[model samples]
Target: MITLLSVYVDLALGVVLAFLLLSLLVSGVNEAFVRLLAIRSKFLWAFLRDTLDGSDAQGRSWLPAGVRDVFAALPFARDPRPPHSDQPAPAEAATVPAQETKAQDAVTNLLYQRVREIDHPTRGRTSIANLPPGRFAGAVLEMAAAEEGGVDGLLAKLKSMGSPLHGHLKGVWESAQRDLDRFRQGVESWFDGEMHRLSMLYKRYVKWVLAALGLVVTLLFTMDGLEYGKTLLRDNAFRASVTAVTEAGPDAYDELRARCERSDPVPCITETLSQPALVKVFDHAIVSVSVPAEGDPAVHWNGAAWWDRLTTPSHWPGYLLTYVALMFGAPFWWDVLRRITGIRSRHHG
Candidate 1:
């Protein structure tokens, strides 16, 4: 029993330590990805700009005029000039009109608004000047954004931070140290929730393990006690007391002596002793018999029987406790698994 208990204790300790290490590992990996994403974001934006300039007309207009004209006649040509730059050169420009200036301003503002829309701190969009003309431009822009290192950059930044990706990683990293501190607090809160759940599960496992061990120990001790009690009843003093009272007339004495020496002596003795006159004689003889001064007393027939010894009130308390544990144990484990794994099962019943 002691050896089993020690083994269980060691296993429980190892399990607890392993869980702690695993949690730390998960947290560290998540933060590292966040930081990597930040660095990747910077380089990704630069690459996208370069790629657009090499392929698109609005971007390629910086090239020689001959090259621009050659590419302009293509089926899917792009205008090298800025949108609305066709008004005129400053010297030949017409006088300002209020309505026209307002309209131009609106167009310029719209362009700026579009730029802002795609400029996420973690995943900025690729330039639209290189995009093919179509109603699918918006979708193409998003796809290009994802392809041009946007998703990779975001993932890298998360890796670099050595933390999990949350909605607040971007603005918090961009801001001052104080903002970063606040972000850490939020991450800490998430970690705390995870830790709490793990602690609860560990406690529950310990309880069930202890309960099983306790049951085994109880059964072992009970069986051992019963065996020792049987040994005590077979002593010389108990056998002598049974033999003396059964000896009587010459015929009876010879028969009883023969039965006493047989290999299965107890059954033959018990049958002869059941006679009313023989039982009275044996009872009186058993009560008078005594062991030596240093030895324990011989076994005797008492009103209290073996069944009386076997029955105990203490068992009721243990059984009640086990029942309560069983009632709650399943639900408690189910709730813990649901909270930790974020899995829900739907059942109409």
Candidate 2:
């Protein structure tokens, strides 16, 4: 009974340690993919168009009707394909024209200028992922109002345009008894509230994209979790070595994450496997009976060889297992491994 229990415990430790390292490597790749594509900028562009002009990502329809317009837009940016869009896309999708024209209107002009002001180095000025409401309000009041003739002139223009924003701003101005600072503060608060809604929407989209990326990565690597675990289970030397590493604590996970932080998917994976701690676990004398290529290793990863294995029906479960394990994420497994190690330490103590 004691020997069997010892074997089971080591098997569990080896499997959990392997998964924790795999999740970190996969997560780094996912982040790199998101950065490379600038998906956040795409999401933001969708948000502006849906909320603004109800046409473009203009501040018009959104600002005029206030929070109701933002609430109405919801997650409209997910499927940005035209012919199906609630509102038709202009010639250039999400391109806020720099030059002001009668066709663009006041709100779009403001949005275009704001995009220029907040353009980040990483995503570039053309497509932006983030903009603060405070800066947005300041732009409207400073640039938009300066040209119009200060607060009074801008207010007079607002009264004539018949915009939804007109009523809200006027109420704030009147309630503040025409105090400039108070009015600006009120407008800033309004923009801040609405911007928060867009942030939440962006995050929800990111979660779904991560899931899709996770599946793609599993397929590309031909990562079969179930099969790998079975191989290690049968190897007493490997199981014992891995259990020792796992029992030693989280040093294995921390070291891998640091090494692979800047690496792409393939390198990230190789770095984890080549880690001194784990490499030592794999450095055992070969004991197999069959010697097809005298010195050729039993397990070698290649796109051609793995792709064939991936197509086999028996290997499908392994792919599914790897995908599910990666989705749990590195942080989740790290915590689980720590608690597990703690339990073992206490038991031995």
Candidate 3:
């Protein structure tokens, strides 16, 4: 029973490694997709739109029609329009030029809104993307100074605008007001620090994108852990082979991880398909589930149809488990493999 259980554990480790590999490839694809789709930038723009252009207490957006148009025009931007629309989308909407114009308009409006009180009140606008944080600090201070209540007024306005820095900015403003020169420098530093924090905020959203992509990949591969486990428990020869592979130590898992990490998605998928790391792992699982151990050997392969397994609703729980596991990525699973091996070694000892 110990040996049998170890074999089952080893099989699970293999499945985990396999999922991790696919996840790495999925991650690579997701990174490229993010760039091609400009997902992060769009998310940032949407964030800015929600924060900079204030919303009502009831959550209705107070952003101007033009500003909302700018956000909607972003690459892979969430459509603000209702899903059920009577009017058809314009033909020009399909063209790249129209999208480019909307992107330009968004950039212009965003910068104009930021510095209208300080720098470009009339002239269309400049790109805030390249504006130095020191300069941005100067601009914000100028706006604050222009207000009736000085820094305190700016803090209240910022809070009303839904800016994340309301409390922090208020603290800094109150503490630094006594020493004006020192306060100016502090504000500049604060602006630079906040800008860095903004970039990190976009990175957090990327993890969500990875999770969504991982779920899609898990379903695509039909990686059902429950089905796999059932077969691993039943097949004596297969279990022995997998257990021997695991007994070879950490190097085996590391090699699989390295293969997935270094390879591109197309090549990774191709190589995995051509020569699956575990020969007949899935095939045996499918066969075992479809045919009794005593069933005719030749007909077992015929019974292991791909569609039959893919469509099985019973496999969903396992598929969800696989999806959740994939989010932890390859390195995490490598550590798990090592720990499992250590536990098994100690148990035998």
Q: Best lDDT goes to which candidate?
A: 2
lDDT (Cα, tens digit) per residue for candidate 1, span 57-137: 243422223422322332124222222221222222122112322213222222223343333332232222221122122
Number of colliding residue pairs in model 2: 5
Better of 1 and 3 by lDDT: 3
Worst 10 residues of 3 by lDDT: 91-100
Better of 1 and 3 by TM-score: 3
lDDT of each: 0.35, 0.55, 0.53
Runs in model 1 with CA error above 4 Å? 1-178, 223-349
**Would you list the rank order by lDDT, best first?**
2, 3, 1
Q: By TM-score, who's the top model here?
A: 2
Quote each prediction's TM-score. 0.20, 0.56, 0.47
**Stretches of model 3 off by over 4 angstroms after superposition:** 1-9, 48-74, 77-172, 178-181, 188-208, 230-306, 327-331, 338-349
lDDT of 3: 0.53
Q: Rank order by TM-score, top first? A: 2, 3, 1
Clash pairs detected, candidate 3: none
Report the lDDT tens digits of candidate 3 across residue range 1-349: 9976876676776676666676776788877875555444444444444434433344544332342333244443342211122233222211111122222333224333444333321122221233456665665565566555766666665565445445666777677864656667887787677667766765565576677788777765677766656644445443343454479855445434444677773466445545433344444233432333355544344244655766788888988877888888867876777686664433653
Model 2 per-residue lDDT tens digits across residues 1-349 = 9867876676677778877876777778767765665555545554554433244333333221333222234223232211111222222323222333322455444455544644534422244556677766765566434443566665565555443455666776787687778878887887787678767765555566567767876776666677666665555543344455468855545544444567763465544444433233322212212223247556433555555766888878988987898788888888889877784334653
Overall local distance difference test of candidate 2: 0.55
